[model samples]
Target: MEKQSRHIFSKVFTNAVLIIFSLSCIFPLIWMFYSSLKEKRVFNADVVGLPSNPTLKNYKRILENPDYHIFDSMFNSLRTTFLSVLLIILCGFIVGYIIARVQFKLNRVIYFVFLLGMLIPIHSLLVPIYIVFKNAGLTDKWYTLIIPYVAFGLPIAIFLVEGFVKGIPVALEEAAAIDGSSFSRTLFSIILPVTKPILTTIAIIQTFACWNEFSFALVLLSETRLQTVPLAMKQFSGQFSSDYPKIMAAMLLTMSPIIIMYFVFSKQIIKGMVAGAVKG
Candidate 1:
């Protein structure tokens, strides 16, 4: 009876902690949603508090603009994120597999260099990158976004995949090879199948990062028609002031897709994380 009581107490304690943590993450989102229903011109000290009355005017205003190109920017961000993540996953898997499976002299050096890329702030490289892109005629296009996103995403993707790859047994590859399965077949059929969880993690992380990135997007992309959601949201900001409610509405719109994705893949992401961490 005492042991059962202790187990219940422990479970309750853990639940309490998780509830607090979840609330912390969720509160800002709740606030943002509340603000979105407010009038754009109204600024109140109690803005974050519950709204006494709600209006969908802000949402309607944005949606009513036929030539605003909000959906186009959304598609632009989505297309770039999709292509970048696909390339990151493919190349990251290949690189991670080779590094984790094969022995080579330069392996450690190469891995360290990848890590170093993460250490350098993106802002630090913006000027040089802008100049290079300008010279290469890559600025103000989807490729401009795709190229940088892939580069930024690769290091972390490689790291996540490497960790998961370390957990996969070497004997499985050997056994598949002995049965006349080619390396590519063994990789796609055997290797990638086992790494779905980790892949999901990488995909989610890269998608969010690329979607929210604003600094480089602001500097590199000048064509209004080609702007992303992050850049488009800046339309609400003027030289002297900003619209809080409309900004909130825009933010809610921007985050809605990712929030839905999280709920959809929360289980797989959790499972993959646990498996990767425990096995690796």
Candidate 2:
């Protein structure tokens, strides 16, 4: 009876802690969403209070304003994120597979090099990256962003993929080889499908990084038309007077897609993260 009581107490304590943590993470988003619905005056008057007068004018104004370019920035972010993540997955998978399956003296060395990249702070590379891009006449280009995003994302992607790949049974590849399948054919057909969970994990992480990245975008992109969501949000702040409600509304809009995506793929995300962390 004492043991049973202890177990129940432990479980209840754990649940209470989890609920508190969840609320802490969620409350800010809830506040932002609520503030977005409030009038500018109401938001400033009562930052945390329930709005007596809710309004959608903030959303309507942001969407209708030509200078805001929220839609264009959204498209650019989507394009950059999707293409960069796609490349990272493809390249990381190929490299990870080779390291895991191919028996070569240099394979471990190459894998170690990728792991070393993770140790290098991205901020440290910004100056050199800017100078090189400037010299190459690549500044303000979408490809510039794509290249660096893929480069930064590769190290972790390779780590996750390689870890997951190591746990895959070799017999599957042997069976494929026996059936007259080429190495590439075996990889796509047998290996990739099995690695889907880790791949999804990589995609989710890289997507979030690329989507939220502001430093690289700020330095690399100069043109107003090329600005991404983060940069656009920075510009949303008026010089003379800040509209807190409008800013909050824009932020909510900027993060909505990712939030929806997270909710939709929450299960896959949890599975992938756990599996990758464990295997890697």
Candidate 3:
């Protein structure tokens, strides 16, 4: 009876702590959402309290304002994030598979090179990449952000995928080979399907990373049409100084898709990260 009582107490304590922590994390977003519905004066006057008179004027203004380009920035972020994740998963899987399965002279060396990319701070290369892009006329293009997103994203993807592939049974591949399956056929048909969990994990992670990236987008993209979420949101602040309500509206609008995606995929994400569960 005492042991049962102790377990109940512990579980309750743990739940209380978790609830508090979750509230702390989500409170800001809740505040932002409700605060967005207020007028500028009401928000500034009572930042903590709910608005006595909720209004949709801010939302209407952002949607109707041609200068804001909120929708365009959103589309750009989605397009770039999708393409970058696709390329990262594809390239990372291929390179990671080779490093895991093949024997070669420079195998370790090449794998370590990607590991080095993870070690190095990507933001440190901002100026150099900008310079190179400028010289090569690659800056401010639709594809410009995709390059860095894929490059930086590859290291982690490759690391996770290589480790995951290493755990896959070697007998499976050998059997495929013995059955006279071509390399491409075996790769795509057998190995690729089994790698879905880890790949899904990589896609989710890199989607958030690429979408939220601000520095590279700020440096590489100058044109308004080419601007991404962070960039357009920056313009939102600049264009509406001290108007906290309107700025929050812009942020809430831009943040909705990612928030929805996270809530939807939260379980799959947790499942994918478990060790050796990729094949399970």
TM-score of every prediction relative to native = 0.91, 0.93, 0.94
- Using alpha carbons, what is the TM-score of model 2? 0.93
* Total backbone clashes of candidate 1, pairs 3 or more residues apart or in separate chains: 0
How many residue pairs in model 2 have overlapping backbones? 0
Candidate 1: tens digits of C-alpha lDDT, residues 1-280: 9999999999999999999999999899888988888875453556766666789988888778865567878888888888988999999999988888888999988988888878898889999999999999999887788898899889988887887898888999999999999988998999998988788778878888889889889989999889998998888788987878878887788777778877887888789777666665
Residue pairs of candidate 3 with colliding backbone atoms: none
Q: Best candidate, lDDT-wise?
A: 3
**Candidate maximizing TM-score:** 3
Alpha-carbon lDDT, every model? 0.85, 0.91, 0.91
Q: Write the per-residue lDDT of candidate 3 for residues 222-275, one digit (tens) a residue.
A: 999999998988865554366789989999999999988878988877766673
Q: Single out the weakest 10-residue window by summed lDDT for candidate 2.
A: 271-280
lDDT of 2 by residue, 146-176 (tens): 9999999999989888888889889989989
Q: Estimate the lDDT of model 2.
A: 0.91
